[model samples]
Target: MNTTPTIDVPVQVLSGPTVLIEYAGLRILTDPTFDEPGEYPVMPGYAMTKTSGSPLGTDEVGRIDAVLLSHDEHDDNLDRSGRAFLPRVPVVFTTISGAGRLGGNAKGLAFWDEATLTAPDGTVVTVTGLPARHGPEGSEPVSGDVVGFLLTAPGHPSVYVSGDNASLDYVQQIADRCAPIDTAILFIGGVRHKPMLDAQLVTIDNTQATWIARALQARRVIPAHFEGWAHFQGTREDLTRTFEEAGLADRLTYA
Candidate 1:
């Protein structure tokens, strides 16, 4: 269960990494993986199994102004169904390599680069790409390049979206550059695959999520990408318990 909106902005976690962040009348989506429970061969020997599907389909999630895809290499981030839905969005923001692969309405954002989106009434929203490490240090070659996102508008609370990032150092870096965040959408699952990087934390774990809140000095926190897949080792209860034990439960919310 979630308490009332702390920032008054609607942040909904649909499933997996898929989230709808409505800011200043602009709808922004993150890592759209809408496929039903199934199996995907991530590596030759490693397979990912989705235990549940999204409650809302693409049609139901109407009017997305942009998609902040962390990366396109992983199935958990962008599945078949999600790939098909990208064209409908006005713009899809992702890594440079992903933009070339996705093409058509997909624009790439390098680290610290800013992209803008306009609403029907000409309200502008700024989206900035942030550095994201998918696994332990020096794991980029195997983990591939991932990116987090930061959104800002004139009066709306700033939102930081951590996309499959595992490093607290990177979070600290973001804090130094853009601290006092109003809302943070953390992707935390403690995901692990024995075949990859000696099985390290692929994303922020429950405890780490709490640290992220502190690092960013965030007023409100919403978690995503923590469940619905076999590789996810953390549970919602674990996340809630972690925050509660840390005396930060008032900052946690679910949609």
Candidate 2:
């Protein structure tokens, strides 16, 4: 039996890359993709297809204080419908380029940069932008700039949100800077696009996720971005087996 305890904060995986996190008096979201199952043309000969949409969309999940967008370029992270939902939010934190492209309440953050959000009851949450590599090293030009986020407060558990990072070196950088992450929301799919990256893994696989859990010594790890798209290959069972084999099953939670 899985003996992992409950996560201090409330986290609900809406499907794919989207997640809802309730911290203290704050409501935060990540990479909202609300589009139904369909094929979207990203480039002339390239397309991404969604297999299914989440049961709950933006309207159902009310009162979002902020959105931690990994990147706005990809349809999987911010689909056409999700783009429409941005204006309704109070603040959006994303990469510098993404913020420039998406103005109006969207704030740009570089690696190691920080943003602040105040809760209703005089609580403050600090959001830090961290580095993320979508594919192999030096693939930014093709993959575009992606970002991760770290949420921290005076007395709250530290939470790390790994966007679409594939490189453990970058993750190690994060662990070195801030260890003992209380909660981690990892976007692992092990997705591969042969034409795009020549069949190279574009996202963290199950083994990498387990390594992250151990490296950060995370109490709870709620996974996302592992399904809903045809390109996604990592499954929950695969991740469970990997974590169990690594002796870190207790840290894995499907919250």
Candidate 3:
């Protein structure tokens, strides 16, 4: 058996846009929304369906190390059941607004703040917060501060987890200022109300993910948040096609 202590990351699609990331022998849950199954129309009224994607039963997941929640939307991220499991875990990293929403049990951290946490084998895992946006175009005052994360293992290539982003500008900026990224786990679904709107409806979609992969020149790209929700419309097929069409099929991998 290969006994190298490397970060082998895997993305498990729970339900619309909700992803479970397994890395470094630890589980990281993102936007854990176990909404009642069915189709729900997007408030502000964009799409059809009250909800979709079967709810990942409480016992469905295992070993949740940390949570990289972007916002405090119940539909997109964080459900009642998910929150109940928070206090059981040692650390829960999320946005300030979400911290409040997560109640006093979970500690809050700012975007770009790097915190070191212990892994299963006592390995020091460095978690760095990366900036993210809810919607595309300009930032609205109403939305909360949503951010991604950069995890660096001692003997492994660094991994970047994009929570929910609509723009590649922030990704490019992160790639430029910080150290080089080896594997980037992007939330790709391109779930939008219209073709011309932003993609953070759940993920950055195909076009933006492509832009980021090229900009950062990352080695491996894992797509998430594409095939889980009722509101989410983008698919892994869409991302694959876009990357292939863009001549980036080899670089972008679907997890």
Distance from true location, Cα of 30 in model 2, Å: 0.3
Q: Output candidate 1 Cα RMSD.
A: 3.0
- Candidate 3 lDDT over 1-255, as tens digits, reads 011224446666676546677666778777666656554444554544534554466577766777766666545566566667677666778877778867765556677788877778877878888888866656545344677888776765677778777766777778786545677778766656553343335357678787888776677787766665555665666767888998988877655
lDDT of 1 at 254: 92
Give RMSD (Å) of candidate 3 vs. truth.
4.0
lDDT of 3 at 118: 77
Backbone clashes, each candidate = 0, 0, 12
Sort order, lDDT high to low: 2, 1, 3
TM-scores, all candidates, are 0.96, 0.95, 0.82
User: What root-mean-square deviation over C-alphas does model 2 reach?
Assistant: 3.1
The clash number for model 3 is 12
- Where model 1 places Cα greater than 4 Å from the true spot, the runs are 1-6
